[model samples]
Each structure stands twice: as structure tokens, then as C-alpha cells.
Target: DAAKEAIYARLKKSEAGAGAMHFPLDRDAQYFEQLTAERIRTRYVKGFPQRFWWKPDGRRNEALDCRVYAYAALHGLLSMGLNLNKRVEALPPVPASRQSRNDPRPVTAPMTASPRRRRMAISSNYI
Candidate 1:
């Protein structure tokens, strides 16, 4: 009965959604234990749904995460336990090219050659 009341109170205080709390990754049950106790004592909540961020490139196998996941991985507190199917490509650095000259071009007559026939060299955006 008391637990039920506490749960209700915690839900009421969760106006900021599930982002309000985080559980550090660890095998030790103490992490879960203290999480529950703190929420119950202060907010009276426990166990919100997990959240994830889609990778910028939208790579299925390379589903990178930010915020909480980044924090956890950086601290060696968590590891991706699943077998992911993806490749990690090393992105090249973007060169600091000078801006195009602002000089205006004078109007000229079209050449006898076909204008549609032109060459194009595509480049990737490396940073």
C-alpha cells in the first residue's frame, strides 16, 4: 500500500518525462538498489523506459548514441553487449578551402561545342 502511494507520487513528479533519471550500467545490484531507494525516497519512482538516439548517418549497424550512452561508454561503465552488423569507416578531414572569388564574369558568346557536354568531379564532405 505504501509502495503504491510512493509510485503514484513519483509518476506525478515525472513531468520532464523519462529523461529525468538514469541508471549507470553495472552488474552490481547496488546500482539498481540505490536507484530505486533514491527515487522512492525523493520522487517515489522506479524503472522508466529506455531511450535511444538514431545515428546521424542513419546506419542501421552503426547506431551511435549520444547523451547518456556516450557518457556511459566514455567512462567504461558500459559496453554494447549485442553483436552488431556494421562497418566503421574512417571519415577524412575537411580541408579549409579558400572562398570563391567574388569577381564577376563578363557575358560571352556560346562556344560552337555542345554546352550540355561537361565534366563533373564529385567530392565527399570530410571533416
Candidate 2:
């Protein structure tokens, strides 16, 4: 319950555009629906009220599950001393001369290594 609450709070913050996370701009209505498919519910069990997450029948909650799993993965990485903010800050800045006049966003150079090599390097860090 605690973990779920924390994840939900982060999600709320992201939805409100007040967090470090943001959903992709291309997500459709169905995606949003699935992302919020579950709700917290309380039921009496053995004369005690137990609060838990619940979703109605026929509702697909894969999006919500994926979000929770992503949050857990981020926490796991942080526990391993992987500082995401520091990593981002360490990225080489894009030169003003390389920026396109039409595009406002600064473009960074692409990785020189192959995708497989990059994957292997990342996996080896935690191995």
C-alpha cells in the first residue's frame, strides 16, 4: 500500500507537470484510461478494514502495471547509487552552432557505438 501510494503520488505530480517525469505526448485516450484503471478500495476482513488496490472486471491495467514497474526499477537503480540527475548533467552540451534554426530544442550527438555494445556496457555496470 505504501509503495503504491508513493507511485501514485509521483504519477499525480507528473500529470500536473510539476515532477521530473512526463508522459509521452503521443499517448492516446485509451492509454490514459488504462493508466488509471485501478483505484484504492477498502474492505472489511476478519472484522478489520484492509485497504488495497482494486480494478473493476474487464478493465485492462497493463499501463498502470508498467508505470509501477518503472517506478520500482528507478528506485532499484537509485539504491545502486545510479544518480540520474548527475548522469544527465554530465552529458556534453550541444553547441549553439550545431542547433537548427527551425528547431528550438538543442540536438545532441548520437552514440558512436552499436546498440548491442551500448546494451552490453549498461548491463555490465550492474552485473
Number of the predicted model whose TM-score against the real structure is largest:
2
TM-score of 1: 0.15
TM-scores for every predicted model: 0.15, 0.69
Off by over 4 Å in 1: 1-18, 38-127
- Model 1, 23-59: lDDT tens digits are 2344365433322332222222366553332232422
Please provide, for model 2 over 98-122, each residue's C-alpha lDDT reduced to its tens digit, 9 standing for 90 to 100.
5675655545545457999999989
Prediction 2 global C-alpha lDDT:
0.78
**Leading candidate by lDDT:** 2
Show where candidate 2 strays beyond 4 Å. Answer: 14-21, 95-127
- The ten-residue window of minimal lDDT in model 1 covers 58-67
